[model samples]
Target: MIGIDLGTTYSAVGVVESGFPILLANEEGRRVIPSAVWFGDGAVEVGEKALRRRGVSPVVTSVKRLMGRRPGEVDDFPLPLDEGDRVRVLGRTPEEVSAEILKELKRIAEWRLETEVRKAVITVPAYFNDAQRSATKRAGELAGLEVARIVNEPTAAALAYGLDKLGEKARVAVYDLGGGTFDLSVLEMRDGVFQVLATRGDTRLGGDDLDAALAGWCAEKAGAGAVDGRMIKEAERVKRALSADGEAVFRVPFVDGGESIEVAATRRDFEHLAAPFIERTIDCCRRAMHDAELSPADLDAVVLVGGSTRIPAVREAVSAFFDREPDLSQHPDEAIALGAAIQAGVLTGAVRKVVLLDVTPLSLGIETFGGLMNVLIPRNTTIPAKAGEMFTNAVAGQRSMSLRVLQGEREMARDNWRLGEFEVAFEPAEKGRARVGVQFRIDENGILEVLARDTATNRDTVLEIRDAAVDVDDEKVETMVSESVEHAFDDMAERVFTEARLKAEELLPAVEAVLSQGDGIVPEEEVAGIREAEATVREALDSGDANRLKAAVESLDKATEAVAARMVERAMEEALERRMGG
Candidate 1:
């Protein structure tokens, strides 16, 4: 089995041999493969070939950022597709585009091993939600390889670090800042067991952002219209140069009308521009520590992962934050892939006496009454874990129940990301009579599987939570929170009205559906009262009055109280009958 790090900007493959993980070079003998794909001349190219044609062809880099995110979820990014839609990169989805990179890695592994490579363990960001994890696995399948596991990057790094220190017990923090993502994971390793405590990161913040910032600074100095891929490449080189030297000069020849632009940039200047991005990673680290319920002082050692950690400024900041020198025992680029190889070894029984216990990055739940989120599985819960809730209908003769599965840390269902909605069909029992057990299981790969079992029939139905539209506005959370506080007075009335209108909209359909189900069961006078309340609500909705709509909704609720109770009673009776019959 081969281990692959399907990274955002670059990827690497490795395998275990003789109880040690060994990195495999590509056909060019290069250890790293640029995560780029190019389509031109009726041919597809990956890695360096695709990267070289970036400015000319329709080359797609950082396609990993688009993984698991819907079309409209990403904004301000230069993409070939429109918002809320998918664009075919040579008739391939983003997953398929990623699969091309995986296929390249598979080929490399096969060539080196002199055997077929069919199974592998892949690593993703620790904070990747359910959708991203699923998409990553799908990409592997499309590449004609069975993904044995979806390991977390930082967790994998921890594995690599702790592999030799199996007998030692320690609390370690893994700070991973890669090309297009940043993750901070806190783990406790003891007796060869690596247990992750907490993980947090910004999928959109990474070395790519810093490169863009430096490129923009260089472009402004050069008086160019915009920074192109070539200029950005130069900016990256200058960034690396400044890490060792006090200053570096970035020169672009013939940028405009046979004129060259040169700018001498100092380390201080690069640090100044990179300060905000670096601070963001630090903030994520602090949050992860907080969630893990430990301070920096509590950490035994802080291990740095990702090539971005090579920057001197990043190391200084990390040192300052943790009050100690960051451990650089492992190579930033190869640690994760190496750890993945170790995992593959364990899975194949080639390596012995090691185990990894990962955790879900976000909370999983369903919407309850009043739009509140009822969490079934809290964030950071150990993987290969299961949590279940028993649900029943509110009225008699209800055939099915619909539940919207969500993933996020938000308190409200609407604020969190909707994984998907599923329906559990029952055998036409009274409300509250059918016994349906809904279980959510997160496997070792951090992917979620929901199952609904009918207790009476002893039948189970597996639900496929497909096409999850995750809200991945990584940079907007703080801005939105601050704006909500500062402008709360200004938008209070509009916000109230909007919320009330939404309630009215929700109540209208629910009222109609309940009435349709209990038409003959409900008293005629009570039905008339419910109809009047519904009409009042409609009028209030049209009048654009928040108070009126709220009052109307309350009235409708009061009018249908007896009917709702009777529906529940009928359901309970049906349930009793079914149990007795069985």
Candidate 2:
């Protein structure tokens, strides 16, 4: 069994051998494989190669953010393809894209071990909801591996940190800030058992946002028309340079209309641009500490995980906040994978000396009357737990009752994350006469399953909730309760139009900037076609037609597909030449 850290920016695979966990490098002898995928004409590329061709093809990066969200629920990202009610690329869902990455990792592990790899343990953010966890398991299955376990990232980090210090008792905080997710978990180690006290994080916040922050600053400094992929890459380089040096010089030649820019940015300047994001992480740390009911002084050690921790500002801030220097013994990039591998070992009986006990990050509940929340499993409860509630019809001749499952600590049902909803049918009888029992079970993987039993007949039936609709006002609830068959589609057109408008607002500037630089590079006819498509997009935007705007966006993407590919190729060549010359 291998342990896989399926991170947002990069992924790594590790294995336990001779009672110790070791990271397994990929075919290129690189331990960290960039979590990027590109859909080419005849082939699909992943890792570094896909990252290099990011702006050329339909590249999917930071897909972990989209794992559990419905296609319509997410509108911030640029996903041009659609498959029925879900987003797709080259006719592949997010799970399929993730499967490709996992498949590659599996291939590398198989090649290195010279054995058939069938089972593996994967790590995800502690705060990931049921939908996300289930989606991750599905991805692993699609990759031809049995997902032996789904471990929390911070819990895994704690395992990696506590493996060697089993004889010591300590309270440790694991700060994990990856490319697209942030999680702060507090754990206590005693004897040979590691117990997680609390975990908190934002799945959407991470280093990618830091890159965007710097890129925005760079765009403003360079007077660039927009923050494109190339600009983001350059900003990332400057960010790394500033980490080692006090200052770094940034230059971009012929950015627009034969104009070049050269600027020098100091560490202070970069920190200023990144302060908000850093502060956000610090806030999460404080909240986690509070949830764990401990002070900074109570922590025996603070362990940092993920590539973002390499930033000096981040490290300094964490040290100052925790009032002590963080333990740097474990490699930030490989610790989670190593810990996962150790957990896998425990499952396979390869490592029996250590035990891991993790907790749910949020409370699980169902909507009660008057828009109130009735929690079944409170937060921080031990995993693989089960809870059940009995319900009766509110009115006579009421055949069924709907339970809107929720996950969060909020008191109001609407404020919590809606896991899904299911209905239990009861025997026809007078008011409160029919009985039904609903069970909510969180398996070892932290995935939820709902089962309904007819108390009258003593029969059980499984219920599947596809779309987890948010809880609304009492009147809306009454309507749903009375209908018991179908829920109304409310404000769908307005939501779609708003989503389309947002996409157009983001894409227009990039299109304009690309066209601004395409005068000499792109063919005249192609440029003309792109300009026409752009006009159509503008018209759709003005007309407030979501479908029209979507069509126009697709047309524009098709028109400039070849040009974008060429531009990316040229940029790559120039970058390679610069490196070789240096």
Candidate 3:
């Protein structure tokens, strides 16, 4: 059995031998495989060697970006090259690209183990939405591997660390700060059952952003007017260097025959520059802990995964947040792959008693009148959660009624993204007479499936939401996929803008309420700044610019910390006073 850590920056393949998971090294003796693929001369090449051909070949990284996109949903995906880069986006789905990577892993596993590897377990972000999860499964199918199960990255890390501590129950928080994403999950383990209580993180936030920020800082220090790709790559190198050492000096290579410049960063300075990113993840951890109803002291242990977690600052922040020195014996980069192998054993009945219970990451709701979204399943809700609602015809002799499904926590359906639509036919009857029972079920896999039953006739209809937004045909999918590649960076920027705006809107009213109540000891100038930030956010929203919304909200977030802290304290005090009958 094989386990694969299908990561954003790099991938690792491993197998269980005598109960120990061992990573398989490639011919170059590197255990970590670059998650890069280049198409050249009708051949698909993956990993480090192929990555060298990136500029001329069509290369894709973070294909995971396409995980949950609906059919026909158009967005630029990262091809990481120019349109004339000789790599035409033709007939290859993200699923296929991912499959090629998995296939390479499988081939490596087979070659190393001296046997045909067929079954495997794969790790995914615990917070991966439905589309990404399904795309992973499809990638496995395309690779011709029996995907034993899709295990959460944090869960796998916990298992890799906890297998030695069986029979003892522990509350574990897995802090996974990876190359491209961050996920903090709280789990309870007892009697061979690993139950996830709550999980939170941003799929877009990670080390990449930190590197980009540092790169910009370096560019400014170099007296450059604009930061370019080479500067960004140099900054990333400095970041990686500072991870293990106390200080790192970057000697930037000049691009236009100009003299090279050196930029130095101490670990402390790096942490300061990366403070906002670390703090953002810490906030997410707080939310997850709150959702699980567990405090920092309640966590028996903290486990870290991802290359980013190797940073001393990240470890310190996590330790401070959870109030525990996390177990660092497991290699952050390889832990997930090891845990995946363990899961494979469980699925293959090699380790016959442990079971994992995952949960949905976001709220799934239906669009009501006035575009209000009624949530069916809220975020952090236990997996396999089921809910039912009764529907009836509003007009006389109505034959069909439609159910518009959405996912997100926004109050308005228009604000939330639509997942799909389901329509059920019923026997014609008087207005508001025909009753149809609609059941929305989310499986352990977190995919939504709908079932509608006609109470009048005992007839039933079941529908699985299709990717009507995805171009499935080889040619069309290929063309769109290529187009997306060309526009990938732009698309990501736009998405970030959109998410930021939504977050700002979520915080605005609360900030205003606090100001009205004089809840905190915030200075007048700070309060004014918060208001200013709110206005900027609202303006971005009104303009319908997702990117602007994101930027404005981020600006507001930076300016309103004092206000937020005070508001939270006031809320806590009121709750405490009410609880004590004061």
Candidate 4:
């Protein structure tokens, strides 16, 4: 048996070897394959080869986002859809295209194992509905592999993280922000069993949004036409570069009319462009925790999974939201594939320890300040859902917050019907200092109850919201309840080499320019400091630690700032004087 993570942007395969599960690399020694397919000149190419042919040939990418979704269901797609919501591309449906990718993965696994793989387990987003799940299985079958089971992405990640620590009892939330989709799953692990309590996600959101943000910025800066696939690919490259170093350059030469587009981007610039998407993920995290009847304090850990989590900004945001540092032990890209392989091992008697997974349905949340629906429970989630969140005082001296229980599809709190409204109070304190842990529990009887605990005074408030009577506006209700890469190329040392070198390129030029003219303008003490900083940077540049070089470059940039400022002032004065003399 083989396990496959059939991802949106990339796909990976794994299998048990010598009683341990490990990912199987491709012919090029890559653990993951780009989820791209190209067809041209009566030939079909998949993975890296196909990805490279993006602008040159008819290639389809990011098809996973359209999987199992109807044409009307999804707002838009790059490809056209048939009457059945099947993606119509070159007379092939999305499933068929997906099957092609699957076939390639099977090839890799079979080649690596030197055995014919007949049965395999596949993974999908935790929030995927029955239709999406079924569609995924169909694609697997089309690839000529027996679809053993469809595992949830987040569940697989949790399995990989907790399989070794199953003797302990703890609740964890797997925050999976992959290349093209996001899934937030709350799970409880105890007694060698992994149980998913609640799961929520947005099928349309993920790292792709981040890339698009940067790509759009690139296009705008280039004054180019529409955002093209080439620009997007370059953006992905620059995004990866920005992940480790301070900045990277996106250069596209010989463009339309013999021009070029070159833009320099810092990590902060990318973060600013990607902030809204990150905030949306944060919103889902809050909602999923509430649905699982968990406060930030309840979770033993928030395991960061998926390639997007590699971004420093993303890690910081998750840390801020959970009030704790995210668990970074798992390799962001390999954990899911490993978990899938573990599942395969379980089926083949190579491994033990069972995993029980669950999901949520329509989102259930409440209205907080700004009339936004803070989801307590996401839709398509399994029944008997319970979750919680920690609310803080928005301002100092605030006595209470009006808790409006809301249910529906809209993001705005006012658009959803209110089951009830009440006040939850805590001791007055400085802003964000007063904390209230609010938990929601839905019993098997379908009763919804909410509990608010004031941490400062240890006071408890309970509200049985089910008895409050849901607003009977069928129209409003109908409008509600809605739908829910680190390149393996080069080792770490080689990967950071270019970015660190680029940082050096940017720093040394300005440093040299300033020192050449700063003899009289800059103080001798600061010049010595600048020289020392530059020497340290050069020493680090000679060493193998790219990260150390980045830090040293930053220090040198700081040390030379005053001198550079003086040079700039003198040059401006010289230019003004020259203009007056002329």
Highest-scoring model, lDDT:
1
Give all candidates' CA lDDT scores: 0.83, 0.81, 0.76, 0.78
lDDT of 2 by residue, 1-582 (tens): 999999988999999999889989977889989888887777888899898886566678788877766655555554455747765656778889999899989998999999999999999998776767878998999999999999999999899989988999999999998888888999999988898888878777788888888877877877778766666667778888988999998776677556766778899998998788888789778877877999999999999998888899999999999999998887889999999999999999988878888888777888765566678998888888899998777668988778888865555566566767667766789977888788889888888888878899887877564532332321122122223222223233434555666566767787788878745767887878888988998899889775777788888878878987888998999999999999
Clashes of each: 8, 0, 16, 23
In model 2, which runs have C-alpha deviations exceeding 4 angstroms? 78-84, 256-258, 465-582
Instruction: Order the candidate numbers by lDDT, best to worst.
Output: 1, 2, 4, 3
Superposed on all Cα atoms, model 3 deviates from the true structure by an RMSD in Å of 16.5
Report the lDDT tens digits of candidate 3 across residue range 236-331: 789989988998987776645687868787888888899998988897788788789988899888888899988889999988887779878889
| Candidate 4 structure quality by residue, lDDT tens digits, 1-582 | 999999988889999888788999987999988899998777889999997887666688888876655445544454455665354666777788899999999999889888898999898887554345656777899999998877888988998898778689999999999988898888998987777787767777888888888988987887877666777788989999999999999887666657788998999899999898888789778777777787999989999999999999999999999999999998888889998998888888888766554554456777765456688886655655789999888677998877777766565565566766678887788877988888877542233577888888888888644311343322122223322112223333443554666668768876777677745776777778888988888898789686788789889878877776777888899999999999
- RMSD vs true structure, all candidates: 7.4, 25.8, 16.5, 25.6
> Per-prediction TM-score, please?
0.81, 0.78, 0.74, 0.63
Better of 1 and 3 by lDDT: 1
lDDT, candidate 2, equals 0.81
TM-score quality measure for candidate 2: 0.78
List, residue by residue over 190-282, the lDDT tens digit for candidate 1: 998899999878788888888889989988977787777767778888988988899999887777556777988999999999999999889
